[model samples]
Target chain A: MSTTDTKRIVIEPVTRVEGHGKVTILLDEQKQVTEARFHIVEFRGFERFVQGRPFWEVPVIIQRLCGICPVSHHLCAAKAMDIIVGADKLTPTAEKMRRLMHYGQTLQSHALHFFHLVSPDLLLGFDADPKIRNVIGVIEKFPDLAVQGVMMRKYGQEVIKATSGKKIHGTGAIPGGINKNLSIEERDALLADIDQQMEWARGALKVARDYTVENLDKIASFGSFDSNHLSIVRQDGCLDLYDGNLRAIDAEGNSIFDQVAPKDYLNVIAEEVRNWSYMKFPFIKEIGPENGWYRVGPLARINTCDFIDTPEAEAARKEFMAVTDGKPNNITMAYHWARMIETLHSAEKIQELLNDPDLQGEDLLVTGERRDEAVAIVEAPRGTLFHHYKVNDQDQIVMANLIVSTTSNNEPMNRAVRKVAQDHIAGAAEITEGLLNRVEVAIRAYDPCLSCATHALGQMPLIVELYDADGGLIDKKVKG
Target chain B: MSETITFTIDGVKVQGAGGQTILQAAQDAGVYIPRLCAKEELSPFGSCRVCTVLVDGRPQTACTYPIAEDMIVESDSEQVAAIRRDIIDMLFVEGNHYCMFCETSGDCELQALAYRFGITAPKFPYMFPKREIDMSHPEIFIDRDRCILCARCVRASRDLDEKAVFQFVGRGPDKRIAVNAESRLVDTNIDVTDEAISICPVGALIRKKGSYAVPYGQRKYDHEPIGSDIEKARKAE
Candidate 1:
């Protein structure tokens, strides 16, 4: 075999991520990584399946998009339905409660990502022994941090369960407003945990900062690239997750467009397909289709936002800035920083929402007359998710088009994986599992939920085909 | 115009529209017939057998039995009640239904119908099969032990929601609702909104993350059926 053929590497079924994915890299005869391919092997047609259901059923139906972050789908779908149905008619209390429930979801999800999923890769070495490098490992090695993470996550789950009726796909959040009401006792219980959660979140941030700062070499070793970042920014320009206009900023930290409406996301962002994978790449409109690569999720959120709203979160953001010079564009390290910053923000935001008096006895749901069409947008843990629906006269859903955040960044993730794989290969003899794992983890930094993004099909086995330097099929493996 | 078919139900001389099923005529006349698996939102699946009524000296599920001209329908007879009780008993015995500790106990349709028929105990020995509880989903829980295999959730998923998140796995009495391809609910594509949880008539299917708020007797259904609430929503719409 030629030197280039020896350099070609393939990694299948990237672990600890939400869904199934693979990475392949091609190198030249000199062993220089030439091309990287990140392949999504599954399809989940959420938007297509939602067509012809009742508009009111959209939230309930779309909530099934992801088991881990059902609230994101629930809120996004509800907000989209609100837009079609007219959001102004909903009571202020209902809106606030919805925001609270959504924040609760964000808290748990971010915690899960940081502590349970990616923390092991960061705290322990990415190449740490697989058996001792998971959430369970965290529990045995760093018992205090693990307990804090689990408890903090539990607190968030409790809040979501209390408001939504179920922890996963709570029926409490509906089209017009929420379906369940919150009581003073529940509010008080959440408040009781707020201080503890904030404390634990602070500790988690400290741990992240210490680890990142100590391992700056390792953190920076992960390939960093120039890509535009996108997220939902509040009207006042503060970071907002539940409801806000979408914002796209270039790699130079310049805003591409401000206040792009949810329904018009397709206009601002376009999806590109590659036959190699099911995931479609999305890019900014102004960047000229092929050149406009944008990133979302934790790194994107941090880059796009000016400052964190809460005090502790702002401190964590400062520490995050210390590592990446204010805007970290490295896709691999973004997972670590994003988890840290989001954990802080989630805790801080939950405290703020819980302190609101209206949350006690406020009207949870607003009964409104159905409209012909509606749209909702929310910042899921991954990125900005959009839900649009058209209802017939009988209020049944006529059509639905959901553009999940993970789907929007699918192309960029693939590109990032390829870039990292090529850089890490650097004329090496072959792709090492460490290099391929980092590439996959780079995608996981965005916390890509393939189930939510693909939106089509069920647990079909993943077929991964390996190619030699000349694109010849070398080997194949099937993963369920 | 087609010729009209007249029918007598429960001693009421009811004028039926042509081609209307006996159950449809009875429903049109505001007469109520107990049905377990009949959801307005889904196609009629006569799996529950609770809607059985005597038609022309034979017991048949009203949902599947179409209206016949001069059909003598006995919706509530001693024999019909006995058969309904037997079916309910079989369902109760086939699954592990410990209603006392169940979240949906008081408001459960199966339990309510059983109580109405004065069925205090199962005639057959309880098939105490071990079942798994899937808490993989952060939001919902699935108690396979409490499932009676009604297939309502499965049908609603495939026919109405079109997500097909739920499917029947295994065969015979060993059959159960499987979320996605795995036994674990979290790993599956089944979202919390799929309504499979709400559609479950027993405690077998449950919302995982939120169970404590109502404090036992104060559930949303304590005062009314979900059907009535849906009716109000429909009327408003």
Candidate 2:
């Protein structure tokens, strides 16, 4: 056959995802993959949106940033506001209530991403018929696990509703403290299903671990790379999702930075904007942008932390580490297992919190000398989230800056897409459905929230368009 | 004038003082005429017109319209209810009333009235008019987007608080609440404890901080409709 001209493959609005993204693949004259770019089309101007508004309202208003993880934004903003009010030390009731809410968010978000979004590809074959390779397909083939996922998600949401005022965009946390405490009735209701929730959480973890161990070889090289990891850890180096100091480690698990204060985030992390993407690439300031880009979310958090506080999750974490001979697991797909471990830990923490007397205390708020500026960081279900705000003397917000988890993972996601393209699509004679699915599998492992990354509002329908080198449309595929 | 007057609201007998308006008399008789601007603590401004009732086959604002002997007021009749709904709808469209993230959502009288009337959305298109936010005060702020021009704050400030800190400026579509100061609330003498700060039926005039502090199912009007207290009072009697 005569040499075919170079072509570009476009995948617009990747399916089974939370936000809008388009993947472009550049092929050379020999049909070898030359470049792959993941473009974020979602628009985000939330920082400007909150300007001139009262600092007290930031927690509520910022929830509009992303529907999937509004709780994370809510808690993080409240944490920043806590510092502004000079309530650096929250009351026991206030701290416990906020922790319960955060853990609830982690559990629900992780469950939704794993069961509803990524499970179909794992439980069913990646090359399975597109029509049946979805949450619906999971429900059809494995009804028990599907129901467990939905119920577990519902349980987490109920916890949020009980702590916050409502399930969606809750008004639970306020400046200096929280709005309400867990009443006996609410606590009892949650306690009723605690055992079952723990059971299901363990089951989900088992599913992820078994699949990873069985397919270790195939996935060890699937979209995998060695880079730096970042997250927050307890003072003693336990995995602390709700609050802690920042810790970063290289691929070999050496500490790059430890115990950095949230207020000094600008001294370390910096964001660089690229022309091709709406989202900015964040990197370690000292290392420079080129090689400083690091990974966040579940895998990074697990790698950066010293130990899991919960018993069963600690066991699981040890097993996960042993697989890599006590090294940071660099495989992209390991995010699933790390995420499940967090889920189990969240369940354990929720049980501990519900039984604590602090959650029932009446002292819910505290105040002290005021501050004009503050910064807060939390481990959102996806990764590390940063919130910084400067308030005027009148208590109005003068400035706001948010580094969302998905935005921090921008370069890593692009690299993941490129790796998948190289392994599956480079020099292929024909682009089969299985090959396209392989690319999606890599992207899904990170569980990216393009909506949060771009901070824009819209729906996404999957559309894949194939174009020739001359810019002629060769084929189109769509799924909603 | 007689000392007392006998009237019927929705065909139910109600007796009240001769000087009382229809809304006051109805309240005395455990009837609620779903109001926005009429507060017992302040003189009725009658700007919202949400309490419109058909008195003797003619429309009248129940807040300002005095009751007469043997007057038949159709407060809950379909005609009157429809008129009230339309007025509430217009109030919603005239300004940007985003109830979703509004701090005063569950506790807002306007939102409660909307819930009682089942107004999921306004029948009219939103004006989406540009509005100013006054956050200059250390203890208080105002979001004009959620303002309904109810003037509760105006009446409470002038008549109750006696500060005369608030007043209505402009006319018709341009009408808005104006503070005594040249531009911002900080320049005025109004404190966070002033009646005007707490009199707002919507999220317009809010004290700084402590928004959405009330949980769901326990907000002022969450479990019951806005006027259910009055109805309950009647039933108790």
Candidate 3:
């Protein structure tokens, strides 16, 4: 085929995920993958702008990282401050409420991704007429499923709202502990709703399982990459979202590192620069420190965890284990399974929290002297999120750095896109929109929030360039 | 350099600190001015417009007006009451305020002011904006429909909290408050503190996700002035 005969694939202004992004795939003469790029187009410099602010204010300030995972940032920042202040000195009730809210966030966020974002594609079929492929479409096509999804999200949100005071940016979880207390009546109401929501979530999980089995060919043919997984694990060796140690494990279930401090995340995980996109490549510091690539998010979490706590989630985990020879390494399909398992676990965890009698007390926050530096780590709905800050004696922040989960999986996302492009495209026929959508969908499976990942905007051209085997630029495209 | 400005409020002439707002002067003169968004901790947003008073010959929001010597201010003129009623009407229409089933029914500033002004029925049609209840965090709760768009919460985030977590998205009637960085409050980053929660005058902002801890009939506002509640909040802080 002539150089001009090469097919170009473009997915413009990708939807369902946070912020804006585009994916482009270029096919060569042999119809093989020439180059694939995941372009992050928006920038808001949160780290730089946060400098010189008070350290006590970091929890509230960093909550601006992502709307969906503000709790992750707030808790992470608060915990980091607590660590700097000495953790044992912090209030126990505040700690409990923080964990409760953290779990609440995980439940609501994962429910959103499973039902509203990804389910539309799986339930309705990705190419099942774009006109009817949305949340509204989900509602019209499967009203029962839609209502369940809404209720599940509402229930999760209600828990957050009840505990923190507001659902979105709850000021409940502060630096010391929580600032608000739950009443017995509020607890009873939350308890009343949990059983129904859990049943709904279980039904949704079954739907996902059936859909995955039905569309094995389509799902398998999408992007897949093998990489080490990293996530937070509890002392009991169970999957944990809040107040746990970091663990890095290989595909064979071998621990690369465990109980790693968040401050030393730089020693275990390192970021690399990529010229094609704003997202940075995160690599394992021990093995591939220079370019030792690793993956985070739903796939990484499911792959690394030894066992889930909830019975329903554990059963889902067993089902997952049976699929990939005891270790589910197929990253593309992990999105579906992670969401189902997490939803089940979130329901179970929320039920347990609502039953706790101490949640009714009013001693939510405890004020103390401000710390000069702090670091916090929590598993956001996407994956592990890290927030580190340095503050002055006046409690104002001097420097800050955030390692967003999406940015951590950048290298793996690139590899997965390339793999999918190679398997599907043959000899450069016009690259169809359906194939491109699949590639973008694979990235969205991680529920990547580009706004939180980049958090800084600069005048960088959105360019897609194709390189020949000899490193010569064959074709270059740009979108402003 | 201590200058005092005399202004006629209702039928009495009162002297106040120079350059103070009519609301502030009237407040000092023991005249009641109903306001939802105005707070001592924040700069005046003037969005609620509930404190509109007849100043000289024009109806003006007392919160925004600067005091002038010999200026005649009517604290409860018919025009002021009408404007306040209209503002309350707009708030009721924009939000999904089901007063009968609300937790803040008796304690709500909007409801109390409405009752005071004899607004038994909303003259405007209810907008019934499709709002979401965010119970994602353990302590804070947000009802987007109940939000009056006074932006006191937004100002609190910017001024007192300094988080800038709450932001007004879209413009005019389409305006809605967003937490942290997203359109949906459930996903956005916002700290659920008492200061942020109490900043909201309408039922839009409330504490936690569950039913009210203090039962409807037993709420503090039923027996005390709303100002006393502010005093309690200040002491607690």
The top-ranked prediction according to lDDT is 2
Q: Best-fitting candidate, measured by DockQ?
A: 2
Candidate 2 wrong stretches, greater than 4 Å = A1-4
Worst lDDT 10-window in candidate 3 chain B: B208-217
lDDT of 1 by residue, A267-327 (tens): 7877676778777777787776688867777778777877778887777777676665765
Interface RMSD, candidates in the order listed: 12.7, 1.3, 13.6
- The docking category that best describes candidate 1 is incorrect
For each candidate, the DockQ is 0.04, 0.75, 0.04
TM-score of each: 0.69, 0.97, 0.70
**Residue pairs in clash, model 2:** none
Error of 1 at A315 (Å): 3.0
* Docking level of model 3: incorrect
Model 1's lDDT to the true fold? 0.72
Write the residue-wise lDDT of candidate 2 on A98-201 in tens digits.
Answer: 99999998999999999999999999989889899999999999999999999999999999999997777998999989989999999999999989999999
| A189-263 per-residue lDDT for model 3 (tens digits) | 888888897898788778877777677776765777566788888876688878677888876677899988777
Give the winner by lDDT: 2 or 3: 2
Arranged by TM-score with the best first, the candidates are: 2, 3, 1
- The worst-scoring run of ten residues by lDDT in candidate 2 chain B lies at B208-217
Give the candidate number with the greatest TM-score.
2
Question: How does each model score on lDDT?
Answer: 0.72, 0.89, 0.72
